[model samples]
Target chain A: MSETTEDIMSATYRALCAHGFADLTMQRIADETDRSKASLHYHYDTKEELLRAFLDYLLDDFESRLACEAADPDERLDTFVEAVFGPAEADDDGDFAVALLEIKARAPFSEPFRDRLVALDARMRETVAAAVRDGIEAGRYAEVDPDDVARFVVTAINGSHVREVALDESPAEARRLVEAYLDRTLDRRSEPEVPV
Target chain B: MSETTEDIMSATYRALCAHGFADLTMQRIADETDRSKASLHYHYDTKEELLRAFLDYLLDDFESRLACEAADPDERLDTFVEAVFGPAEADDDGDFAVALLEIKARAPFSEPFRDRLVALDARMRETVAAAVRDGIEAGRYAEVDPDDVARFVVTAINGSHVREVALDESPAEARRLVEAYLDRTLDRRSEPEVPV
Candidate 1:
């Protein structure tokens, strides 16, 4: 991305965080950015176009973070959880979550947004499933269907995200709950004792 | 509610289900109802007020459904899950889910919506906690912190709702996954056998 594009994206983020998706306007984004409105429009014709580009940018960043190789299954799982849950403190204010949700709520109406979200969901699920498979192979986890568990994990994280953003609940609680559930379901330590 | 108010609320529901919250307008709602635009204006005064009333109507209906006494703990739990996950087929299209998500996403910005959602969450948690406590007392469930489990259950349901609407996933899968998890964690059948 060009430096100007990057600056506009950052400004868009700031504006989204400040004004929310409902009230977000091109004028608001232009006010946040150093560039002229005409320049911004030259790059992207409409607010939806700009926001869609922003969504793509976010997914690209997310994919890059998940692309890095992890040496251990636990580390992979931890990274996945951390990416979904983010820092505990970030959950308190929910600026990022609110913006993401604004886009998600639009998915039903917008085909492009729906497709992008589906792709993102698929990538996240695949990453987690691979980690679960690795853990089972390494004798570090219990026997369970990795695919099923993966779906559960994704759904749970999404659920937690909604609760955190909607109810102002701590994301830490979601993290802890999911981690504990994963421990019980996947951790070898919690596996039943063998018969004598 | 008066008969006219009931008719207006019904029209609002139809309009919401059709156009969604983002595009909803008093004129559209008026189109759905037999009443004139002026009448809708007199009844609602604003779109926000109408939506607030619609939300209250939903909560009232929800509370009434839940108010019926259930004798068994499992029955109570099953009812709660069903309410959250809804019918499996409903997940496929997500008309009601989309409208509800619209309101939930707005809770952060709307005080009335936020307070109503908070109250609904509290009512739900209290109901689930009571069932968990009842099960524990009756030796039908594993001993666990009812409050913690209640929070987890609600979070999971909220998460599943997000996935179902946002990604168009099956609520059946979410329902099965959560029921399985609950069985593992809370079901007496899954409890370990004591050594003789």
Candidate 2:
């Protein structure tokens, strides 16, 4: 992407975090970026188009960072959980969560957004599943269906985010629950031995 | 409530299910009820007021129904899960879920909406905790922290709703996962025997 394109995307993100999706406008975005509305329109024809691009940018950034941090299977679960529940770089006021919820609310109506979310969810699940599989193979975790465990982990994380945004609550309880789940399900030492 | 109030509320529900929260207008609500715009204004005063009233109505209806169906402790978990994941009364196109997502998205910014959501969540957690306590007392379930389990259950349900809305996907996986959780946590036989 060109410097101008990158600047526009950053401005869009700032505007979204500031004004939210409901009140976001092209003019507002342009003002945030110190560019004319025509310039924004020239880059992206519509608000949905611009936001969709932003989603793509965010997802790509997340996937790449996850790949880098998740190199060790033993630490993958902790890393993934932290990334999902931890504070964002520019999210001191929790505006990132708010903006995410706003865009997510549109997924049911917008096909592109829905597709992107589906892909993101699948990717996250896959990452967890791989970690679980590796743990089991290394005899560090119990032998369970990796896919099922992955889904449960993802669901817990998603639920935590929802609670955090809608109720202005912390994800501590959710984090603890997931940790308990992992301890119970993955720790083979805690399982009863089968009769020989 | 008066018949007039009920009629207006029903009309508002219909309009919301049709046009969603973003496009909802007093004129559209009046059209749905076959009442004049002036009448709607007299009844609701503003769109937010009408929506807040509708939310209260929905919550009251939910609490009453939950009270009726959750009389049996053994059936309480099943009933709550079904209510959260069941088909809606007026949701042939799944618009009920969409409308709910829209309203929930506003909770962070709308004090009335946030208060109502907090109350609803508390009631749900209390119901689950009560059921768990009763189960333990009756020797039907293992002894566990009812509050912790209740929070986990509520979080799973909330997360499933968020996933369902954002991906337009079914909650089957979430349902199965929660069922597994309850089986593991609540079943006495599944618990390891205490050493004498």
Pairs that collide in candidate 2 are: none
Tens digit per residue, CA lDDT, model 1, B1-196? 8999889888888888788888899999999888899999887889999888988887787786676487788888888877766652333367877877877888888888888888888988898899989999999889988888888777778877787778888788888987887787786454458899
Instruction: Give the alpha carbon lDDT tens digit for every residue of A43-132 in model 1.
Output: 999998998898887788788677648778888888888777765234336787887787788788788888889989999989988998
TM-score of chain A of each: 0.89, 0.88
Per-residue C-alpha lDDT of model 2 across residues B71-110, encoded as one tens digit per residue: 5566887787776666667444677777887888888889
Native-to-model Cα distance after best TM-score fit, residue A101 in candidate 2, in Å: 0.9
Residue A4's C-alpha lDDT in candidate 2? 91
Which lDDT tens digits does candidate 2 get at residues A1-196? 7899789888887888889888999999999887899989998999989988888888887786676454556578777777776667655477777888878888877899888888899999998899989888887888889999998888888888888888888888899988888877787443448899
